[model samples]
Target: MSKPLSPSSSYDLHPSVAYVQSILANLEARTGRTLEAWVALARAEGPSDGKARVVWLKAQGLGASQAGLVAQRAAAGPGHAFDDTPAGYLAAAPGYVEAQYGGKKAALHPLFERIVELARSLGPEVKICPCETIVPFYRNHVFAEVKPFASRLDLGLALGDPAAVADLSGRLKDTGGFRKKDRITHKLELTGVADLDLALAWLRRAYGRDLKA
Candidate 1:
């Protein structure tokens, strides 16, 4: 597993966010240019199209991965979703969750909060990492995610082999499979607080599976 964001920091990060931060943190060391410099280069000289800019950066001597990262930052420009630094992104985490539950989805905030409470109760290691749309709950890995809809929420779980789990026989819908590279392999649609009991049960199972793995 990767190291925590900081020795004294209390926040837990989603794996994808962590990966991007890792790449950005090392950008200067690997390419001799900061992310700001790379974005400026891409905007000034590279193609305007994002994919084309990645190719252009690669041709200009950046590795494939670094080129892709630079292209993404350039395309997003200033005030990007994850921001320009790890600390900045971490600071904006709460706003991300608030955005997801705003407007027509505001009514679902209570349900999302309840789910978060249950997820945290599982263990202290359970980190609530909110992205633009979904809120992913991570244990050793991402065990579950809570995605809000205008009228309902989808609780996604990474249950290993849903077919073998009798308790989840018809209680969840398949989210493809790990073999197919889907981190969340099943989901339960929750319309209200009444649906939480079943959701909590399935969440516990998913968390336990990740714990053992």
Candidate 2:
């Protein structure tokens, strides 16, 4: 099941925020330093380059992933806060689909909006969240995502096995498949609302497989 949303985080209602909090909570025990401590060190009591900070963190015994997270958050600079809700994220996140659609891709907004409407109607158990750069629809786990581009939208579905869904080959793009992960194994290009209807059947299939009733 999706984890319960946090009530104390900067972006308490955002799944990403909760996920980040969980990661941070384990940082002190895993690396002997809290996120705050690492950020301060990244600042180096003055200022330091990202590569230099990562190197220093590595010297202090942190693995590549841990050091990278620390270096990234540190390099992000101060006051980098997440929105408290999906709506806010949609409105504020850089390169949000709506922003992309509203800007150079205005002609694509109606199509994306239609897709979102259909996705939101999936079921009561589903959560439609706007993450930093993507709109993810989740059941107990993420089953699909709608990623918009300057020209079109990429509809991602977490269908369990690619071979079993061969009938869907005409619409699937090879680029987004996660062969080893299996889930989110297909991506379909969406150019208009007419595309949503065709995608719904597979979306339901993905939801059925990835999300338990």
Candidate 3:
């Protein structure tokens, strides 16, 4: 028989596994069943996978959230939502994107919306996400970011060859070695949609450069 999962066993587990592990660590105290007990029940239900196993656990009398955690543990073993996967992180904080533009920051919502619209048009491969601090625009990797300030929005782009975009230095302004290793070597300030046309043009070129790289 496999050894039971313990909270201290989460050193190298996936984010989702580690996330579930924390809450379920004291499983028997709360749910009246140890982690091993839950998995044994799930396995007894016969061969299954993913949501199906979760559904089975729920029908077996575990509450929805607990069942979901047990099913995930049964399938993949120990870990937590902070493990590293983008989906895992998002699952842990579903309102992260909305919270970024809520309250006093609401004034910048439209600006981020416009940036997202343009980012989506880049291609099917583009992933616009709030990674760490900045909302990064990813094409294979982060090719751009939309960071809002209380006064203006800073649009960062990765155009690879700095010289090719150096002519815009007076307009776009060099990032002055911020995250120097990143392809996002330039930034433009935007106060409103009025700046969208020029920014979009720069992003289009940056997208091409990112794909080529």
Top candidate by TM-score: 1
How many steric clashes between backbone atoms does each model show? 0, 1, 11
Query: Per-residue lDDT tens digits of candidate 2, residues 25-109?
Result: 6889988888779878777752478787788888878777677677777786633234133455534543444455566777876
Error of 2 at 155 (Å): 0.5
Q: Is candidate 1 or candidate 2 better by lDDT?
A: 1
Candidate 3: tens digits of C-alpha lDDT, residues 103-138: 777788777677777766767767655643457777
lDDT of each: 0.79, 0.66, 0.67
Highest lDDT against the true fold, candidate: 1
TM-score of each: 0.84, 0.71, 0.56
Clashing pairs for model 2 are 158-184
Q: Residue 42 of model 1: what lDDT?
A: 92
lDDT of 3 at 29: 86
Ranking by TM-score: 1, 2, 3
Root-mean-square deviation of Cα positions for candidate 2 versus the true structure, in angstroms: 6.5
